[model samples]
Target chain A: MELTRRDALAALAAVGATVGGGVLAGRYDPPRADAASDAGSGSAAEPTLSTDLLDLLDAAAEVVYPSGVDGRRTFVETYVLGRTENQPAYREGLQEAAAQLDAVARDWRGQPYADLDADVRDKLLRDLGVETAEPVADGTITERIRFYVVNDLLFAFYSSPTGGRLVGIENPIGHPGGIESYQRASMSPSSAERSGGTNER
Target chain B: MSADGGSGGSDGGVGDGIDRTPSPSADVCVVGSGPAGALVAHRLADEGANVVVLEAGPRFEFSERTAQQEQHIRPGMEDPWEMGGPRDAYSTEGRHYPLNAARVKGVGGSTLHWQGMVMRLHERDFEMQTRYGVGTDWPIDYDDLRPYYADAERAFGVAGAMDNPYAPPREEPFPLPAFPPSYSDSLFAEACERLEIDMHSVPNARNSEPYDDRAPCLGYGTCKPVCPSGAKYTAESHVAKAEAAGARVIDRVPVQRLEHDDAGETIEAAVYATPDGTEHRQTAGQFVLACGGVENARLLLLSASEQHPDGLANSSGAVGRFFMDHLFAGAGGRLDEPTRQNHVGFNTSETHQFYDDTEPVEGLKLEFLNYAGPSPVIEALGADTWGDELAEQLNESYGTHVAVGGLVEQLPDAENRITLDPDRRDDHGNPVPHVEWSLGERTERAIRRANEIQHAILGELGASIEWTVGPESTGPAYHQMGTTRMGSDPGQSVVDADCRTHDLSNLWVVGSSVFPTGGAMNPTLTIAALSLRTAEALSASLSDP
Candidate 1:
């Protein structure tokens, strides 16, 4: 079965429940831009995800996300841009990670990562084994890719309403679901029969 | 000498050094625009008194509140209110207290971000020494403030039910029906029923319906730092009402000190500074210091004179002593099933069953936390795995957590007080308020008791406890109390039973600062009640003369 965005978001909600939600999100100052090619830029342009980096994220999302989700480009573009806006330190890290992914892609398939077929992109990521690698800013290429590209994209998707709906959370933490939504029992398919109103204090 | 600025005063006074806006004197001058000052100003203005409220912060536009809420939700966003800066600096001599985090310095004051929990203090809360043999008794008992408590409930449109059997006697029902328990509250209900612990609906100042012309709660779930929907009651509403009733609320004017006549029997004027660095003295027949516990003490001490060198109303030597605050304790854990936490920000149910007037432990009030678990986005990012494995991790972890938090009452200790830090001066070149606070053995004991109850509930659910906060990790709940405590004796306290200063006849102090003995319940409701009573006394005195 093709995993849906809802399934991915539900997983995100589960992770939030485990860790106790939003407590770890943005708790620290965004790590200083890694000492990669995107590290030093004296230009006056505002810090944000570049057009090229967005394209790379779009391609990365194809393999990183659950298969068969629609509007991958628009979702990744919108989410990554919003995440990196006014965040120079964070944007630089993304740029560095994008560069690393492209470097590996060109070496393996003789094309930019975005130009490769979906299966090829998946194989490239798998071959790199970035998923199993430790996420580190200044560590190995796989670690930087895991830290900057994969995790950033995952956080964006899971935190969104679409992502939260994949699982059971209609309105994730930090998002307001009208008071009536909270007053009702869990809308998750498995627990829909468990009435919440009956046990009033 | 008084600087009337043409508002109407017997004595004419001039601004110091810089050109100041000269205005007519007011009948009553209120040196804060928080809930305490706003309520009093509205009541006095409605009763045909000329009132002027001086607020230290700028008037935050109500329309911009949604954008401010966005800042609170968005990561790495600047605080739209910009509450703390050089002008609002303070330090701590003992335990670190985040004063800026606990307070806001604007026209609406800290109510802008407070969770809207309102509860009446029990009768035993007044006569602590007589019943418990530990804390001092309040000059006025629960009966004295009962009518005013009802008035406050009506004024704020409190949503509650007559369900708390342990609550003090009340002649009237709540102004609005209680908010229904959150889904998470039901999850705790099962364990509470098994333990024979009682839980009841929490009284909230937030509107249940369209009462007082404000909208009902839209369940934004961000009640603490921001409530985008105006459902949660803020002092800003009262300030607006006071303005409608012809009360002049001057924002961005921080009152430096109170100036008294040469004999020092009464306050002559409130010396204040505007944003433009111009000093202006507001003279009135009567003055009310309605700043919070810390600022109120700082202001009184700032007004040192030859007649009262210790402070303006410090003849009793209790101006900045007996500071108190409730300590927080909690327990959290994960269950096998999804608990659906973090869906709501405010707790809808709580228990006062453990509250005891006769027990050596000051007692505690427990709350079923609605927003306790980690946010999905942060949890996803922090996980070690990525892709399918990460998704599987989130699926396994979501909606399986529960948490319980409670407030433990603190006893008044002169040693844990708010004093002036002479070394650190603010933007206005005035000394900052320095707090010296340490937990007492009694407070720790109450916290341990609270922890035991919390742990039992979490344990009853067969959940693995993730963390527990006890005396070692406990912190203040930010309900600052005592300081300028009220009492009948002139030598032991700064204010009398009617919130009138012992040394200065026309000067009055209000708000949680005048709480004789701190109670475990949230203090804003009690503060509102006291402010209403003081307003009546102030207006009656003004009309009689």
Candidate 2:
């Protein structure tokens, strides 16, 4: 089905279970350039992502976190910029990531930045992530972006409507049970051992 | 020093009429503004008392400080301990059960970042000394505090299953119904029942539905930071309520030394410092020292005068003794089936069998904790030190596993104490409280047994045990308590059963500092109940006079 933004959000909310009956529909929208510009005023000019890179990031996010019934993607465009400037290490990491991608792309097609097909892009990205590229050094420019993207994707997904629902993020305030035996067990050694017999199921 | 015309001049005329002095004066002076202090001030002000709560730390607000949150979540700033601002946090003296908890100084106190788990202590907890013979009994039993617990529950708008057969009896139903369990909780519940371990949903103080004008929890997963939605109950909420009630809460003022008259044994005034370092005095008809456990005792120790050399109200020499904290440990294993519910919410379902279990420890209760899925940093820490095994485990368990942990009671030990540092002082030049703690053999035994129980429970549930140990890399459980205990005899305790200092009739101490023993469960609910009881007593005293 072709999902409208409303349908997408509803599906996402159903998936996340975060939007209860009280959620005001259409209240949230992607921030306008005015708001974004205001928030980023003091920082250097905002860096523009090449359409190819954006496509690559979206494709990667889909593979890592497949779209749920909500049909909405988990990659928030803001995350790319948010981490880049507010996070210095992330900026350097992104540049190094671009370099790695270049290396992978070269090995396959000998073409530079702008000319790559969807199939070539997917193969190059997947190979780099799997076994082709050498392991990135810890905290290096290349390593940081890879970590940041993965972490951001995971965080956004889990916290999002669909991800939240799939994982079961309940309303903490209305939760019905008293102190759980498991929680109590987790806190004590003797009880933990006694209760250890039950966790396997 | 004879004040109030009472006749008891023993101890070198310390209470002689010769030193009688009028009580300090203040429009509204609150002693300890933890949950109780905040509530009382709010209620009294709502009744129109000019309330001024005395806290030892600078006034703090979650939104006002961004440094800690910014640094912790920022890509490279991933240090676990580096989340909060320096002055905004407290550290334990060593790796012990009395682990130092992060308490906020500004408006809300520790509630600003609390998990908002508000469960009433079972009725048996009040009579532990009598029933279990392993600990001292409370001056007032659960029955006495039941009404107050209800009031606090109403005030905070707790959500939980009132019908839970295992729960304590309540005169009134919860202000709100229970919140739904997350997916993870349901899975755990199913797994637990299969193994015959009892598990239930967790009760929380966060709003299930809007109560008292507060919004419902937004589920931001950033509760450890300030709740932007203000759904979590903090002293700040009470501060606002108290202000509306006509109470005045002066922020950024830290109480230093409390002055008591040597002759009459009555508090004269409290000496304190403002954010700017200027010294000031607040006198009231009565004075309460609600400045948390460590700070409360420190104030008394700092207020030593010729009349009471050991420190004001320290005749029994037990002012800074009997420290206690819950001992924490856990055993968890990988389940054969993917518990795909791991990421549903923060903790939801938990085991409760250990709470009233007759086996093992006769007197202690055990509480289970379902900490949300492991953070990436924690996941990395657990990964194999040398191989891609760490990465593989991280991938497998990242969002598809569930683990249960434990919170065990650490019985109080007199030798475990909080005392003044010989050569250390805070930024205000005030002596800082130092804690000296060592677990008694009973606690060690409890840990050994609990670990075994956890292993068995998980194994029965068809899970492979991965890690089983006590607090990782952190010393002692951080729920610090038992510094200033209450008892009937002045020879053995600092405060009386009423939480009043035996030596100084008008000087009352509140907070967990007055707890003689630290139970295994979280102390916030009990502490709130006790604070309310004290406030009731104070209110009566004020009205009668």
Highest lDDT against the true fold, candidate: 1
lDDT by residue for model 2 (B55-171), tens: 654455444333333323334443322223333223345443332344545566667667777777777766777777777876777788788888888777877776455667888
lDDT of 2 by residue, A1-201 (tens): 111233223222311223333232222232223454567742223332322444445444544443343343323333343334334464555544554444445556776433566456545545445322222325543344345444444444433333333333321111211223222222222223345666865
- Model 2 off-target regions past 4 Å? A1-201, B1-27, B56-100, B188-196, B262-264, B341-346, B357-359, B362-372, B375-395, B470-477
DockQ score of the complex predicted as candidate 2: 0.05
The true-versus-predicted C-alpha distance at residue B477 of model 1, in Å, is 0.4
DockQ by candidate, in order? 0.23, 0.05
lDDT of 1 by residue, A108-155 (tens): 787778788988987788689875666676677787887778766775
Contacts from the true interface found in each model, as a fraction, amount to: 0.43, 0.01
What is candidate 1's local distance difference test score? 0.78
Clashes of each: 23, 96
DockQ of 1: 0.23
Candidate 1 wrong stretches, greater than 4 Å = A1-68, A72-160, A188-201, B1-22, B378-393
